[model samples]
Target: MSDPVRPGAVRAATLTRQPAFWVVAALLAAGAVRIAQITGRFLGVYPLATVTAMLLFALLAVPFWLFLSELDFLEREPASLRILAFAWGGLVATSVSIPGSNSLENLIAKLGSPNLAADWGAALAGPTVEEIAKTLGVVAIVLIARPQVNSVLDGVVYGALVGLGFQIVEDVVFAVGAVAQAGQGDQIQPVITTFLVRGFLAGVWSHTLFGALAGAGIGYLVVNPDRTRAHRLAMAGLALFGAWASHVLWNSPLFREGLGDGAVALLAVLVFKGLPPLLLILYLVRRAHDSEAAYYVAKLADLRDPVLITDGELRVLGSGTRRAAARRHAAARAGRRGRAAVRRLQRAQARLAVELSRDADPDLRHSAEVQRQRTALTELGHPEAVEGDPSWRHTVSTVGTTVVAVAVLWAALSFLGNG
Candidate 1:
């Protein structure tokens, strides 16, 4: 969605013009070049298979991208930085980590028994090298765009994007490798099977989760610059440690030692291994989002400007479910146009709220954007009905749609697995 405020004064910051933006842009371009170099041989051999694999994984990534984007609703990050994060993960992290991880594995094999290295090499080497490589994407963004990441949630958004980019490319590589392994030149089956296991079964809990954990830590350091250096370092360390430990756990052979004995057992093992970290990251994300929302609510309330944002609007916008319901209510009262206008109004209010929430500043009322959004609310016809009890069915519809999407994907994966 476009920014709602006037272009004259409340113009969106020209992030592309920033030096840091250009630096990240250059890195992303370099990363893309490196990726092309790495994949050229495979692309030359199996152009069709590689393209199909890339498309499938990219399709699977849509819902996740939307979810992470929604998490940063109040203050969306610039698209350039978001794309940069994704490029870093898919290109730079993947390109560098492949050789680095192999070197680590090779060293481990030389130092230890081949059997031990075979079982544990990825567990050790991957966490040490891959986690850092992936996180460096977030760190680089932080270094370049210091003001962009204002909260832990911002870090999670960037981190998840990076991980997502990495996951898509890695999944494509795995799928291509699977086709090669099948050896019958049956492209579809191997690609489908790979997608079933990696994309469906474990995609959510893999690199994306690890990157978010690490990004939160990097965010903590940037967000709380006033905190003690030791405290910030601890936070950063914890973030990296959490990410490494999670990567180690995922890469370890402990689960594969015996759990593949039965189909049910294997499914159980997948759930057992993936669910905990998924739940943990979910919890952290929720906590960060809640803190962010609360901060915005307090800031909006402090403004005490009914013209711009009222207590009722603040209450409704504070919760995700409620926000959805308000839009539904607006649609019911008017039509699609009403819904669109209200959405624009809400976006303007949210932008203003976010601007005001930055460090408890009170003079944000003078911000040009703040004035524009206030004018917008009046012209858009602020509906008093939005503050009323929302239709509970609206919340149900939103959640039901998500549940149905997952079910359809699950069934599709199952069909592929069986065939």
Candidate 2:
């Protein structure tokens, strides 16, 4: 009663407090700089070529985005945040890192043996600069919206998005560079070669994997409130080190040792060099997903409300294929309306699970959102029960088949291209 807050002061406070505002500002600034750089670099020289490369790589990025997006089934990040992460990776991180890395490489060459620098510059400077730059995007997202990355899986999703942006942009850059280097008036071949090697063969275990590893540490630091600060710092450091080590290994010349100059040798190089890290990251991602799913499922175990989420629904939600089958079944039963309602129900249930985990509250029926979604589901004629998730064996088999198919496709493309 003694003091009334001024309207201006209130508005200022609100603006300063909003993480979303800062995020938007960062994206705009970074995006402007990036657009300027791209225009300056390519507009005068290879305008159409650059555009074509960007468009092609962007189209390639879609499948990767979809694949990584599915990993965060419980709580997807907001579109605004996702866009911010991508922009930071593509615009901010790449913008700064390119010049910084080149300078570092030049410095190393001047100070030391140029031949040694030429051979190991990437292994040394690339990992240090690139990992930090990409990881910074994840850190920025966490700083702007602490709640967006509530689990390791959430971190991985955002990290992957950031890396995806960086990957696409970098691929385009490499393709353009290849075109210029060839100087043979045939840009298509160079572009295709770059895309085949970078976009297809090395896409899986590249910057995206490094960013995810680092982001997992950052997320663990932000989410686990009870952990001691020292422990959190250690986790953060360990993650960065892991990312740096992985990047170093990838860029190192060790893989070139015994590599021959044939298609089979190239395949062997990819498999031997890329497979171990790919397998390691896959294991880490799966474990992170399992931990998050278990946490949310445990929170919802006692809940039995059909409107909110049933145990059967919980099982289906954790598995991607089951979720798809459930939606298909609903569509088959009551047409598109049923499918839409089921989606709504699933989204609401996911949101509620997130809220429950945050508050550590099992009794979520009293939440307004819970009641509203429940009413919506009932009004739409609650979708039929979903079949349970497949056994671990089936899931593994499906995943393995998908991986094999992708590898075979890449090999076929390479074989055809050489032919």
Candidate 3:
């Protein structure tokens, strides 16, 4: 729905430019300082290799981080606050969660019960505290800027980014520590190998996916007010269970044997345990996308400008890639104004979908629907001409999903076999 309290376009435009400019400038300055430090390093430090490992870990993390950051649902909040929340998740949340869990395990062990430590680490500390701490970013976002979280996926994306941040920092620390502890004059190859395996292979299951699953539960609770507290609690339980199970399986002694045995066991576990939940989540996302598209299509039916959007365009918008392509086409033809209009229409449709999913008072929902329709109509200008058939979206989504599934399966197999 149209936010009656939407920021003035002029102010938003000015603020938008500042983020890009500052981010670039900051990155450049940091890069320069890092290069100088590395060049000045002494013989004891393999500065070049250390820097490379850090950079590689960061590079490995960028795709996941960018994926989470690109989510439009988070744009409502002040950019600085959002960045701070992510940084907090990466640094403070991770720092505390890791050492805190370790301390708990040590306490359990010191109590002359090592088995208890292992059990608690797997069942409680790993899932309960870590998942909550990782997902605190979503909580902060919701409490500080409630409007930013309009859908379950928004929470998932934000939480996943926070997790990715934590994973990257943790991996870099491990790599650097490995080299430092290897003693003076030792080869850096082992540290490099550790970086590759941890940063690339195992990183997917680290904080990112755990936070995503937990965030999904939290998102369901925040957006679905009609759900009873008991139901919300159950959802939380299921999410934590999933996170813990995944972590436990990944860290299980079964993998201590070699990659082949580990791969077989892990594959069986993932198929039975992991794939179903992820599939269900994907189904929910598709339903939400379709509902959003349908609402906007219906709302704009009465517009005098019949060319604002077509059934074909609505179909295209039902999938992520196609929607992106459509926006790019519009921007290329009609400039920033057209792109902004498309974004507004998309956001209005998304908000309308979220409202539809809720059990809000009938009058409130109806009013929201009306507002969304009006906003959509106002923003949808002349439709830009684009090439390719409408069936392209289905093809794209199918190919993209298949590729991701295969890649994930391969990674799982590799980790199970190698670990």
Candidate 4:
């Protein structure tokens, strides 16, 4: 599942010949230095706050990293390329956005009225500069490692990572700023408050979401080699616009005045601004995943080998939900070992499918891996890892979880309102 240099990874030989490699390397180095300087100054002034913010945001990044990495698990984006995308987002985009946003903001102030700039400048300026910078991170991937980004999901993975990188770094800066503005010397209270508000509340619909929206566009442009140049470019522009518009809506002051300062109002504002993009990204991810699944699953189906993968297993492999269900189905028969065996079988089958798609002849090592997992599943007493009859337990668990989440959210909002 994790390879240092997977099939789609750019090789040293390839990098040596590509000018874009050297260019990106240089820019990343410069951006890293810029960010270090800014962060260093913050640390010098507010040692406690800066370190706390860094730790908090760094911790926050873990789940996002896992989600995006698994987003395109079948033909997974190379880890090296993924790291590059994150580096670009954290160092390049954040560094550029810091000053680029300010310059654009001043322009907005001069061109429009001060009141207009004060109100709408962030909506306009931040999205325009930041999105461009982040989307360029995707483009840089195309320039340097085109192989890893063969699918639309590949673009989303890279784009979201770039956004995640930028989001974490930007959030850290903002958190420390919040502490400084609290007028309390190097306190963790403001940092914690910012974590709850910005990291917890706004995070789902923040930079990563915008990056995915835009990345979907870039992915469409790159992957659709069949489409006309004009059409591809137009779609990419449309996608970028969607990302920028989403950012604008999130940052705009239009909703703030209408919604009062209460926590419920804040919750409503978050839902109004965030839910649309969240749904959009979900739709895009599902579509991209289905397309990729169909491509790889078809290859496995062509094998027509029961020992390697049966029709039922292929069906399970074709869907993320069914794949999870298969594991649960296995767990019901045996236990944790059954679940683990099912997961391994799925991964092996996926790897074999990917190999079959790329190479006309199946890779022996991958095929052997699939058979090995199948053998383990047999030993676990759940031979076929296909999903069984739908369970009432799953339904009850889902409903119960949903209820608890809603109740907790209501409680938090009520407490905030009271405060």
lDDT leader: 4
lDDT by residue for model 2 (39-125), tens: 578756877677777778888888888787767776676766777777777777777777888988888898887997888998888
- 32 Cα displacement, candidate 2 (Å): 3.1
Residue 217, candidate 2: alpha-carbon lDDT: 79
> Per-residue lDDT tens digits of candidate 3, residues 367-386?
45545544544455534323
Flag clash pairs in model 3: 259-417, 259-418, 263-416
In candidate 1, position 371 carries an lDDT of 57
Per-residue lDDT of model 4, residues 1-419, tens digit only:
01211246469789758899999999999999999999999999999999999999999899889988887767777788889999999999999999999999999999888898899999999999999999999999888787777778888889999999999999999999988898979899888778877787788889999999999898888888677999999999998999999999999997877887777797998899999999998998888888888888888889989999998988888888898999999999988999999999898998898788677899899999999999999987789988889899999999999999888767667655555
RMSD to the true structure for each prediction, in A, is 4.9, 6.5, 8.9, 3.1
Give candidate 2's whole-model lDDT.
0.72
Off by over 4 Å in 3: 1-50, 71-82, 115-124, 180-187, 258-284, 291-304, 324-387, 390-419
Two-way lDDT contest, 2 vs 3, winner: 2
* Error of model 3, residue 341, in angstroms: 12
Candidate 1: count of backbone clashes, pairs at least 3 residues apart or interchain: 0
Off by over 4 Å in 4: 1-9, 411-419
Clashing pairs in 4: none
Query: Which lDDT tens digits does candidate 1 get at residues 26-142?
Result: 777877888887578667877777778888898999988888777777778777778778889998888878889889999999999788789999899978998898999998887
Lowest lDDT 10-residue stretch of candidate 4: 1-10
* Candidate ranking (TM-score, best to worst): 4, 1, 2, 3
Pairs clashing within candidate 1: none
lDDT of each: 0.76, 0.72, 0.56, 0.88
As a whole number from 0 to 100, the lDDT of residue 192 in candidate 4 is 78
